[model samples]
Target: MSNIKKIVDIGDKELEVWKSGKGRTIIILPGMMSSLAEWELLYEELSKEARVIIYYRAGYGKSDKGKIPRNCTENAKDLYALMKKLRITSPIIIGHSYGGLILQEFVMKYPNEASEIILVDSTSYGAHKLDEVEIEEEDGSSTEAWVEKCKIYSSLSKEVLQVEMAEWITEMKKNLSSSQHLEVEEFMSNPVMFESLSEELEHDLLTCGETNQHKSFPNTSTIVIGRDPKASITEMVESEGLHRSEAEEIELIWQTLILNQTKLNYKTTYIMAEGSGHSVHLEKPEVIKKAVDSILNSTEVED
Candidate 1:
């Protein structure tokens, strides 16, 4: 992988943008709390075929904390500005998880600036309606209520914050080597990381609402890669005190929502990444590369 990196001044803040390889640009947007480093494997593979543009979203990695609202529209605006400043137009966009929502907004806002889009285990508008699930909380409220109550994390000390986020860190470590673990640890130590996560979580509903306002996607080739809901059924059942049947039902609903997301565009394809949960790109980078290659090859043929 090349080590070329630069800072782009995006009005409110400077974003750390990394670019490598050559040919058509493939701009990658990371999920909430996910940094550009998480895209290392896929970036290396895709960069071999085309120019890969990955950046640290504001408040992640080497980027400055942003002042804009942490909603999908604002995030898309930042990306549009960055691409304009970099003189990149009509590039392929790949969004993972929350990044998927941002990409939806981007295509909606810019309409004609994207050649194609790939969504990796992305959040769906139907899934955004958390009220459909009846997972009760300690306060007799639903899981959505608990999520709203727990959004304030900016004031926690580093030690406490680390403990709170230990589960995910442990999961990430399972896939990383010692050096990678150390790098992840250093990134997690940044207080801004937690703050940014909190901001995103707090405004998640608003982001979905904004995204819903757009009725159609731009006329572009699109791929929606969804995770196997079965892979996460056990965890969901245990954590939410759900019965086996209930968990299975919820899983079905989740999968359905993911499938329905493809309806936003006429030219759309859906693929299920079996055995991979939400982080399909991390769990199955090769699958992502195949999808990307297919898109790039098709683009080549069209040109």
Candidate 2:
């Protein structure tokens, strides 16, 4: 049975989590607004070699939201505090999407906390490069109304974001005209919040510039996967329409501009899933599992 324990006494609410396995310590952090349970199937495969630690962020999962910071920096701090409390030394860190950004920040703040880091089709460019997508309201007012709509249509959009479907595209288009635009301006304005989160991401890229340390992590057996440019998909709601070319460019930004900025300590294996889109893990779980397995077993890996 999967063991899930709420971590208490820590400043920020976190959880002590794992399935079953023993060897290296692997810590798994899911995407933003996601729960640790998201790893249900992935854990089955990864736990075969090492103990997997999947914790719920403060605002996510069973963890309470009070007193917990939602941005990336605070999120990383929470993970660090949890590790210290649990007495985990040099555990391997694995992050997906926003989770990846948190780990990336943590690594910069505390470079030696992990024996290795694995990024699974994650967003690394930070808020600056993140696609500013918004939904317009009927009254021509721009608000997080889109995210609110998302919360309402969570069940359906969840599948759409994870797996590309024509219906989702159609629904998104239906709202475009009546919807108002909300840019990242609001998200970027919170310095104590947003800027702090972005700093770590910028540092990671900066570190890469001084030295192509990308190979170093890989030498330590760290692995990273980039989304396929060709298979990328974007949904434009209402009046918004994502042309095939634009979607492909988005993938290129991640692979060519964002991810490529890092010079790995070891040879990084870049695999592109032709059939998959942004959410590669959901679109192709088997492929993700295979990649994870290979990295875990490879002799080049340290932890």
Candidate 3:
């Protein structure tokens, strides 16, 4: 299949988008820290039967930098703009990590624009608030790691950081080839990316609160794909060198948020990706492919 890549100017920002195949459309809003290149696995399989659209969101990778206060709501607006430019309507939208929060904002704002939502290990609504859960840790958890990464990205040379992060990523994903790490390393090595990343981090609680304002989103068919937390907890314990108890507590918080999503969406099915961690799309892509195909088949049958 011929993969078409182009720059789409959506008003203020120019977005780098890649598309392939035809029939139905699938829009993937990857993690803010993610690369469009990293979605090659999904594109390779899904594009055979569907029009899979993956892009570097404004201010990430090759995409033009976006406006300041790069909160989730703003990012959601960017998604809407991109869709409007491409004349896409009622397409299946998928979000992972922070992208999920952006998806929530989009659904809340546009309501009827998406036919379905597939949340893959997405950051849950209101999970950042202290009152959202009973257990709280004051010393810092994963945030500390992100802060350290920011420092490292700024301090290290691009060549050095690229090698180290490539090896680290390969170990973490296990299935990814080192060749695939180029785009990811390039994005991470840029100190400017951390600026946008940190701004998003700063406004995360605000975005969560705003998204939580919409308790009843459109009754669009929704599917939740959560990675088995055991693997993630083990990663936190080993990779981050955290105590088992700390990691368990962190995982517990994450799972609680993920499970709470079921109560918010109508006709939602939750699936846990066994032997997979946070990056379910990378580790067990077949699960996602099946999920997408199921939703697409059902949608077409109704159409």
Which of the numbered candidates is closest to the native, going by highest TM-score? 1
Q: Against the correct fold, how does model 3 do in TM-score?
A: 0.86
- lDDT, candidate 3, at 264: 65
Return the lDDT, model 3, position 187.
Answer: 74
lDDT of 3 by residue, 167-275 (tens): 6555534455566666666776666566667667656753455544754677778898998988998887787776787678778888888898776666789999898
- Span of ten consecutive residues with least summed lDDT in model 3: 130-139
lDDT-better candidate, 1 vs 3: 3
Off by over 4 Å in 2: 5-8, 12-18, 66-68, 130-221, 234-241, 261-269, 299-303
Clashing pairs in 1: none
> Relative to the unseen true structure, what is the C-alpha lDDT of residue 68 in candidate 2, on a scale of 0 to 100?
32
lDDT of 2 by residue, 175-226 (tens): 2222211111211121222222233333433232333224223244456766
Worst 10 residues of 2 by lDDT: 180-189
Q: What is the clash tally of candidate 3?
A: 0
In candidate 1 the C-alpha lDDT for residue 121 amounts to 82
Better of 1 and 2 by TM-score: 1
TM-score of each: 0.87, 0.64, 0.86
